[model samples]
Target: MRGKRDIERELIHAEAKIESLQTLLESAQTDRQELKSQVTKLQDALVAARAPEAYRDQQIAKEEENRTPRDQAQIDKNRLIQKTTEGYMHALERPMDVDDLDALLARSSMHDIKGPPSLHGNDES
Candidate 1:
């Protein structure tokens, strides 16, 4: 008879726990719905903020006016060409010696220095 009463008490405790869990589940669902509503409202606000104004055309026109100088510079360059006489400017130059070349390379921070030629893969010329 004592064992039967203990089991009855444990059954009541389990039922109380299940009721508490059910209440928590309902509260969580309500919170989820509120968060979803807030997210929708924020998305709508972002869409409105991103919409172009009525003066957008005028703004674009002003920007195009400001870009005239860059456009003119491009057009000026397109009409210009190098003269053929410029070709002989370096025709008589000779390769520099190691010391002079090294000095120039040091001045340039060695940014343009190339790797040494490979000797291991020269089966042909």
Candidate 2:
């Protein structure tokens, strides 16, 4: 009976030791994976550093390719705005006939006349 108990005790201890080793093994595997990822990142950085001008040109080309559409859109927007603004300015600069002014004034309640004077003058009115 004593020998049987001793054997069982040794078996329990062996199992506990195996479990601890397995935990350590899992930890080591996780550490190894993290180290491998870090090494890969470091290798990429080293390669970029070795050929910096090539890397810079590649990055610049990529940026310009991305920016082309945005630049074109901005240019189109500016041209449209400028065209609309010029149309408004040209309309403001044109001389209005007194009859047209009288018709415009009749439709609205504004009594003040601050715009450019009629080309035909008050004699035409």
Candidate 3:
């Protein structure tokens, strides 16, 4: 009889242990799910934080690339304009000497020979 009682008590103890183990498994699963959620949230936050900075960096690089050619073209245009202005101003500032004027007239006379000058009053210089 005592042996039978001992056997029954052992069976009960085994059943209690099984229940405790099941509870522990459920708690562990809940903890694992919570940890997974936390990790996902952290990943999303990190991406969101970095996205704008990455985009801004890319935009800045593109702007710098685009600016180089435009700035160079502007500089070239300014140089060309400055050179043209200087040439025009130099021409206006200097009077041509008679020798230089004669040279110019002789060069022009060659082209003028192709067309007759109108004789209306035109012994016209």
The best candidate in terms of lDDT = 2
Question: What's model 2's TM-score?
Answer: 0.43
Q: Flag regions of model 2 displaced more than 4 Å.
A: 53-125
| Regions of model 3 farther than 4 Å from truth | 53-125
- Which has the better lDDT: candidate 2, or candidate 3? 2
> What is the lDDT, from 0 to 100, of the residue 11 in candidate 3?
100
TM-score per candidate, chains pooled: 0.40, 0.43, 0.40
Question: What lDDT is reached at residue 82 by model 2?
Answer: 53
> Residue 43 of model 1: what lDDT?
68
Error of 3 at 59 (Å): 21
The deviation in Å at residue 59 for candidate 1 is 26
lDDT of 3 by residue, 80-116 (tens): 6655554545655778664543444444423244333
The reply for model 1, stretches above 4 Å from the true place, is 52-125
**Candidate 1 C-alpha lDDT tens digits along 18-119:** 999999999999999999999987865665577654245445555756765566666454333111122222322656555544454444433355535342
What is each predicted model's overall lDDT from 0 to 1? 0.59, 0.69, 0.66
lDDT of 3: 0.66
